[model samples]
Every structure is written in C-alpha cells, then in structure tokens.
Target: MNKHNAEYYISKLGLLPHPEGGYYKRTFQSEEQTSDQELSVEFEGKRRLYTSIYFLLGSDDVSHFHRLKSDELWYYHAGSPLTVHVIDEHGVYKEYKLGIDLENGEVPQVLVPKNSIFGSSVKDEDTFSLVGCMVSPGFEFQDFELFTQDELLAKYPQHQDIIMKLAYDLIPV
Candidate 1:
C-alpha cells in the first residue's frame, strides 16, 4: 500500500471537496463531506466543474433560455405545481407540469440531457425546486448563456416569433 496526501488524492481523482459558494443560498452534505449537489469540481486541471441548486423563495417567475453543455437533474424536494419547458435542437418544444398537492413530499426528479435548451417557472405560492448538473469533463461559467426577454424582442420583432420560441405571451418583462 502507498500513502498519499489529501490534496494529492483529491487532485488525482478530480474531486471538489468544497462545493461552489454563492450559487445557492443553502446546501447539505454527506457524512463523508461529499456535497448534496456536487456543484463543481476540477476537470483534468483544465476546467472547473459547474453545478447549482436552485431554491425558489416563493413562487418565483423566471423566463430565460439557458443552453447547457452537460446533462442536468431537477429534484423537487418540496412544493407543488412545478413546470418545465424544453426546446430541442430541431426547434421542437414541450412542457411538463408536475405535482398535485399530494406530490409535494414525493420527491420527484427530472433529468434533462445535454444539448437541450430549457427553462422553468413555479406556479404555486409555496413552490420551490432544486437542480443539480453533472458536467462531464467539467463546466465553466462562460458556458452558460442566458437569453432574456428583452434580447428576444430585439432579435425577433414579430409577435409570432416570440410565441413560437417561448410559448408565452410577452407583455414586457
């Protein structure tokens, strides 16, 4: 058997002992100190892992398209009436609404594969959700690109374009 320092072992395995801070308001850890979300890690010393847990304070309204390089998991630990919208590369789109009042404690998990455009919104007053992303080979902050409503309007002056892309009626942010 051989002995290795903590940092050496960690570096060899590309582990992130400490999850990225400020990405979420709170976090949880395992007894071994592994993160509940594993928000970030090192990637062959080339890139940093990117992970996040979204905590909705109370029925937040968010509408922005983010293109992700890695797969992601959405875990609903609490709340109800969660909605997820995904757009594929072929310009196809669909919506998935989850949870009845009884599904609040059921702990449903949804996975979005890599190379998909996605966004979400919470409809219930007490609704909240957490998301986890596992970016193979690591992820970087620059990988995230947000397309906000204003940018959409500027790019597509036609009302039908907005509806086709986002599936909603835009009344100015």
Candidate 2:
C-alpha cells in the first residue's frame, strides 16, 4: 500500500465516517461564540466563532448534497484534485476544482456560500483527496441539511446529472 493512501491518513488522523460520506475529524472549534441574539433564525442557539475539520474523500466516495447555514471554505491539503459542485440559491450551477494545478484552473481554496446545495468528489481513480474545511459561526447538527434526490430534483431539475450522482436515494426517516 502507498504510504499516503486513504487508509493511511484515516488511521493517522483518527478520521471516522462522516454522516455526509467520506471520513473526517474535527480539528478546531473556536472558544469565541455568537449569542442567540446575534444569530439568524436558521440557527437554533449560540454557536462558536468557527470550526474546522480534516476531510478525506476517496475516488469512490461521495460527499453527498448538503447545505449549511454558514459559509464553508475548503483548502486542498494533499492527493488528487477535488471537484466541488454547487447549485446556488438562484439555481445557478457551478463547479470549482480544488487543487494546486493553477494553470488548469484548479484553485487551492474554494468557498461554498451559505444555503447553497453542494457536494464534493475526488475524480482520480483509486486515489483520495485530503482537505481542510472551515465553517464560520461554527457548525452544529441543526445547521446541516442533507438533500434527497426527489427534493433536489423538484427544485433544480436542470442539475439532474449531478443531483442524481450526489443526492441520497432515500433520506432516513
């Protein structure tokens, strides 16, 4: 096995299965917080100033379509380039390549705006991508929203291919 393969990082970083797919471990959570009065209706209560995690996605893995109440920034750390698919609030679909290959339009950092339905995948066969994600105003279970195929299809029919590939076939009841 290669020294830096998916399993190698998973074990080294103490990554565990993430609800959104792939593997991850929270790396930071700021002590500073936002009070309930400062947060919007989407937030349940107080939230930390920011939170970060180390995320790993294998070529065969799917991050799945999900949205958060706060913006998320993704930074490429190692391995293959990652493709981040986004369907904005206005229904505009865009893809950002996160990697070090600048000439090919791959960016080292990409941002997913709040409320956008988005997902990520690693395209290189048999390899994986390691990344760091930071969410401002922190991240709470209540702020996370995973999509179902039918629900996303109803709203963004034009993004059928991506939605079908990334959205869950069935949402757990």
Candidate 3:
C-alpha cells in the first residue's frame, strides 16, 4: 500500500476541487488565443491555445463522465494505476490504463479525442493516482458538458455497465 493518502497529496500540492470530480489545480494556461476567425464553429469564442492541470483521484473519488470540445492528453504522475474510460460519439467504449507498468500494458499517457465522454478512477482501491491533463484550444466552461445518466444510457445502451460505473451523478460524490 502507498504510504501517503489523498489528503496528504492534496495538501502538499494545493489542489482545489474539480467540477468533473476529484481534486485539481490549473498548472498552465497559454496567453495565445485561437482567434475567432480561425476557430471552428464548435468553439463558442476565442480561447487560449493550451491549458493544463494537476489532477488527483483518491480511492474514494472518481472523475465523472464528461465531454469536452477540445482534445485532452493525460499523463500519469504517481501512485496506483488509473483507468480512463472513454465512450466515443459512435458509442464505442474503451479503457486505457495509466501507470508505469509497461510490461502489463499500462501506458504513461493517453489522448482522449474531442467530444468523447470520459472519466477515470484509481484501479487499486487502496491507492490514489496523480496525473496531469492538457487540453488544446484550452479548456472553456462553455465547451464542457457533464453527462446525465439518462442521456448516456439512451445513447449507448450497450455500455450500460461502464456508463453506470463512471457517471458521476450515478454514484455518491
């Protein structure tokens, strides 16, 4: 078992609460913006070209199913393995394990495509995972959408098990 608990790391890293669940702190934001003229219609307005955050998930916490308009990259930092669950727009479900165990097929980083519903949790119940997330076209509140259980189930009935497992609202927060 890990020597440190979630509270220890939270205090050490000065992380704040994240809307999608878990604790996080914005680590970087680019000053450069994607000009309105150059941005796609999906984007509401101009946004910084990049942004990143230090994300942490305790054994009791789960990053809920949510979708962003911009692509996101996840980098594993420490602790137990994290399982990132993704359900693409076409209803395809996939899971990516983030950890240092390359021999066991765990990858240190993963890219979640834009508009794909995604969530994460520590694979080991006794441990926590610290990670960094980078978003391109920078993150904007207008580009984020939290999933409702009903909406997700209706769209992807085949992935019911995972949907129920990862949807934030379905579980105690």
Q: Local distance difference test, per candidate?
A: 0.46, 0.93, 0.88
- Which of candidates 1 and 3 is the stronger one according to TM-score? 3
Best by TM-score: 2
Per-residue lDDT over 62-165 for candidate 2, one digit per residue giving the tens place of the 0 to 100 score: 99999998999999999999999999999999999999999999999999999999999997899999999999989898999999999999999999999999
Q: Which regions of candidate 1 are displaced past 4 Å?
A: 1-54, 98-107, 125-127, 130-139, 150-173
The top-ranked prediction according to lDDT is 2
Alpha-carbon runs more than 4 Å astray in model 3: 1-3, 170-173
Clashing pairs in 2: none
TM-score of each: 0.52, 0.96, 0.93
TM-score of 3: 0.93
lDDT for 40 in candidate 3 is: 69
Report the Cα RMSD per candidate: 13.2, 1.2, 2.3
Off by over 4 Å in 2: none
Local accuracy of candidate 3 as per-residue lDDT tens digits, 45-100: 78999999999998887888999988999999988999999998888999999999
